[model samples]
Target: MNLKDLPIDAQPREKLLARGPAALCDTELLAILLRTGTAGRGVLQMAGELLGKFKGIAGLLHASADDLKGFKGLGGSAKRAELIAVIELARRALAEQLKERTVFSSPDAVKDFLQLHLANRSHEVFAALFLDSQHRLIEMKELFRGTLTQTSVYPREVVKHALAVDAASVVLSHNHPSGSVLPSRADEAVTQTLKAALALIDVRVLDHVIVTQGASLSMAEKGLI
Candidate 1:
């Protein structure tokens, strides 16, 4: 069950060096991060257990330090810190990409940026990606929390933030903790309401994205926007 017990080429580090990182499965890659395991659990076993507990890599990466507490191999601060740091780095990398290029040029990146920010929440969150005239990201703000009914999300507030950021266009985003990225009637109604309100100020609503832990849906792509 130990790394040494495996054939050298079968070990995580050995396999990574032999065939590159893409060749390693999630467990092997995570085992390398973990380094070692508890007295009884091997690193691969511990890694598998962690992934299972969290539901997979995306769930694990988004896990908070407190969420990792009491886990066998992750009881130490170092491993937990590494995991948290990785996710933060990914978010910053995506943010940097959005800052450097037009969002429309790579729509998947925008969805990824929103997914990393909005996914894994236990409740609904209504957020906006305020963009510059060239459609590059200016800021992403979480404007409303709790249920995302039209009543709960105020278009006036969204318009105010858009003006404050000097955004010429905006992408609306929200998370469905229920794991369904399907936009409900409320989602459509609020998008239209915000679209109308922003139009009054000469701001454009570019897209409305619904995100969950593992998937995302773009209203613009669906012609719902």
Candidate 2:
């Protein structure tokens, strides 16, 4: 049945307005974005079909524009743009929150920020959090992207960037797209090499965080630093 045929409380739009977005199911949320469905299908039905086809919200969000355009209900360029915009907004919001707060002082904040930025990625990424002498955030820079298992990190380049920014210390981070937060032998060796290089310029290496979708590991906490 169409949404209009359902009881007011049973409708996704009505329920959303009455309660909150957090209360809505994934299908309902997608229905709102889709707005309407084809001639015989209700918005909710279309949403369910789309979710099934994409294997869920994460798959849909990460889908390429061409992939989305191939889908019946999501073929329009406007719809594709809207979905991409929402994802970008979410990433930017997390980044902005990290910038506005004390990044290093709170371990939870750092984990949450890094998780939001790196967890959902499909490949490896190496990033740095440059902090002032007080441990306040100076800047967050994404230095490299690599294959599923490894990335080539140059300690000399990292030191150069730290000096350019006058960073007193830094939190090094990289994601394992394989979803394992355990630091490999190579990860440990590179962290040590970067630490030694940065120390030459008196820029302390505070921590090396290994990020995955499910968890993050701190090298300092593990006594690896």
Candidate 3:
């Protein structure tokens, strides 16, 4: 049956309008984005199939443009483009939120922002958040990207960049493509090296956060710093 043929309250769009977006489940929300259906399936049914095939919303969001283009209902260029655009907009909106707030006052916000930015990535990425004396964010930089198991992180270069940015403090972060939030021995060694090197220049190392697909771990919170 057509989505419009359903009872008004049973419709995803109507339910969303009646109860707001937060009231809709992931499938319902996704169906709205998909907008239409195949010959015998409704938009909601197609959305559900896509979610199941991709392993839910995270998997779908993490899928590459080429990968999405190969999906059944998403094979069309216009739908694939729409999906990619929506994902990028979400990332940009999250970044804008971070820019408007002070990192020091909201440590949780930093964790949330980093998780959203890096959690779905298939490869590892190392990033730094530079802060001024007042702990306001000065800059956020991605210093390196690497394979699943390792990324070459340089203490000297991190120090150089910190000095160039004149950052008073820094928060370090990297994603584990393996979906494990546990920091490896190399992760610990690199954190300590960077901390010590940054200290020589009177810059403080606040935290080193290891992000995974589902969660993040803070070294400072673990007393590793």
lDDT of 2 by residue, 10-127 (tens): 8888999999999899999988877778788888998999888866775565566787788886777787798778867766776666667666657887887677677667888899
Clash count, predicted structure 2: 0
Task: Please give the distance, in angstroms, between residue 161's alpha carbon in candidate 3 and its true position after superposition.
Answer: 2.6
Q: On residues 126-152, what C-alpha lDDT tens digit does candidate 1 reach at each position?
A: 999999999999999999999989889
A best-first ranking of the candidates according to their lDDT comes to: 1, 3, 2
TM-scores of the models, in the order given? 0.94, 0.81, 0.87
Scored by TM-score, the top model is 1
- Once fitted onto the true fold, the runs of candidate 1 whose alpha carbons sit more than 4 angstroms away are 1-5
Compute the lDDT for candidate 3. 0.83
- Residue 52, model 2, lDDT: 88
Can you tell me which runs of candidate 3 are displaced by over 4 Å? 147-151
Name the better of 2 and 3 by TM-score. 3
- In angstroms, give how far residue 63 of model 3 lies from its true place: 3.0
lDDT of 3 by residue, 149-188 (tens): 2348877778899999999999999999887899888888
